[model samples]
Target: MAQSDTVVRILDTAEALFAEKGFAETSLRAITSRAKVNLAAVNYHFGSKKALIQAVFARYLDPFCEEFNQELAILEKKSEVSLEELLEVLARCTISVPATKGSLSVFMRLLGLAYTQAQGHMRRYLQEHYGQTFLRFTNLLKLSSADLPDAERFWRIHFMLGAVVFTMSSLDALRDIALSDYDEKTRIADLVARLLPVVTAAMQAPVPEQPELVKQ
Candidate 1:
């Protein structure tokens, strides 16, 4: 196999394993076995287990960050963009992946693992590559919801991320139950459409005032 093909095979196997077993549980041996690549190849292609994990995340995040940043750049050029528009862009980023990339569900599971696992390395790596894109996202959120206090905006952004991660990661279980229990077809695309409004509402929610305390 070509060197590039070998690298991709390793990465593809690692991504699936990590998504299924998580960063801590999945081992290099398991990955090598699944990828049909020898230990020497894995060591040659990726120096260590940590580096392999980072590569697995990069496989999904690089494309997502690239597409999101491109859309964000265009949106910024507009005279004005609604909060819903911004939310839709974020929603579309995850949902559209399945159509364009065959690994949407797996990628989402990996993303959820990123949040739950010790992701400092992966997060910092992506940040180094996509810091400006994230900064732009924060700035856009500030502009779109000018009324929100800085603290509120920060927390809400985290909230939005949590929702996105949970929604995407849980889709499989949810879809299964829906199919067995209700016989209804709950697709990722449909869920994304429903999620947009909830995320927008969360982002645009009014900042609550600190309540006055009565003497106890």
Candidate 2:
């Protein structure tokens, strides 16, 4: 087999094993055996076990972030970046783009594991490297909601983001509940459209008009 193909195989096996098991539970020998590669291949391509895990994550995470930024850039060029545009970009980049069945599920399961189980270098690597995407995204949100106070902005974005992420992970369940009429393939786009307005409403609340004082 070609070296690149070997590398890809190793990554695929590692992602599945790591997700189903975990960092401590998974071992390099198991990954290599599953991939049909030797220990040398894993060492050659990924350098170490921790690096291999990071590579598996980057395999999915990198492209997703790039697509996100690309979509945002296009929107920013077309017009002012509204909360609507932000929501749409997120829905499209995140929930809608997984081409194959079960890809999103695999990613979500693995990602959920990473949050709870992975640690030390693994956790730090994800936060320092992959987490940059959110840092950049938050700046855009700041631009979109300049009027919101610091505390309000922080919590609002927090709640909105948590809703979006968790929902994407459980989208199959969500469709059964909220959108029984649609298939999973179609549901993502529809969900994005339907939730966009509701989230926007949550973002907006009545701002009290300054009371006019009678002249003394």
Candidate 3:
């Protein structure tokens, strides 16, 4: 296989494996076996197992973040924008990533894995790479709610992130439960539509004042 094809295969296999089995459990041997590449190919391309894991995440996040930033730039160019408008763009950008069926869900599952399981170099690599994307989004939220205190803005954004990450990670289970209990057809495409309103609401939720603690 061509060098580029080999690299792509390794990344794809690694991502699938990482999503299926946690990153700590998936091994280089398994990735190479699934990709049909030899051990030397992995080392040649990625240098080490941790680097390979980072690359697997970058393969998805780099493009997604790029597209998201492009959309954000367009929104910035507008005369006016709202929290809801910016968040709607965020939701649409993710759902619009071109891939085979269920690919987005796989990406989300991998993303959740990175948050809860990744450590050391693996976690730091992602934070270093994607940190700006997150910062940009938070800045936009700040712009959207300039009147709010810094603490309020921070808490609201944190809640929004929690909502998005949890919802994406639990999509399958949520769909099954909804289907069984309510006869609801919660298709993947429907997720962005459902998620937008909920996330937006969280971002706009009223921040309560801290009550003073009495002296002990």
- TM-score for all models, in order of appearance: 0.87, 0.73, 0.85
Q: Which stretches of candidate 3 lie over 4 Å from their true place?
A: 1-3, 211-216
What is the C-alpha lDDT profile of model 3 across 105-148, one tens digit per residue?
Answer: 77777777777874667668877888888888878878887777
lDDT of 2 by residue, 1-216 (tens): 334778878878887788678878999999999989999988888899989888877767877888987776676575467877777677678765543665675677667666577467767887788677776677777777778876787778766755665666676677676545543444566767877787777766544455799999
Query: Which pairs clash inside model 3?
Result: none
Better of 1 and 2 by lDDT: 1
Best by TM-score: 1
Clashes of each: 0, 0, 0
Q: Which structure is stronger by TM-score: 1 or 3?
A: 1
- Candidate 3, overall lDDT? 0.81
Q: Assess the local accuracy of residue 90 in candidate 3 as a C-alpha lDDT between 0 and 100.
A: 83
**What lDDT, from 0 to 1, does candidate 1 have?**
0.81
Please identify model 1 stretches exceeding 4 Å from their true place: 1-3, 98-102, 211-216
Candidate 2 weakest ten by summed lDDT: 178-187
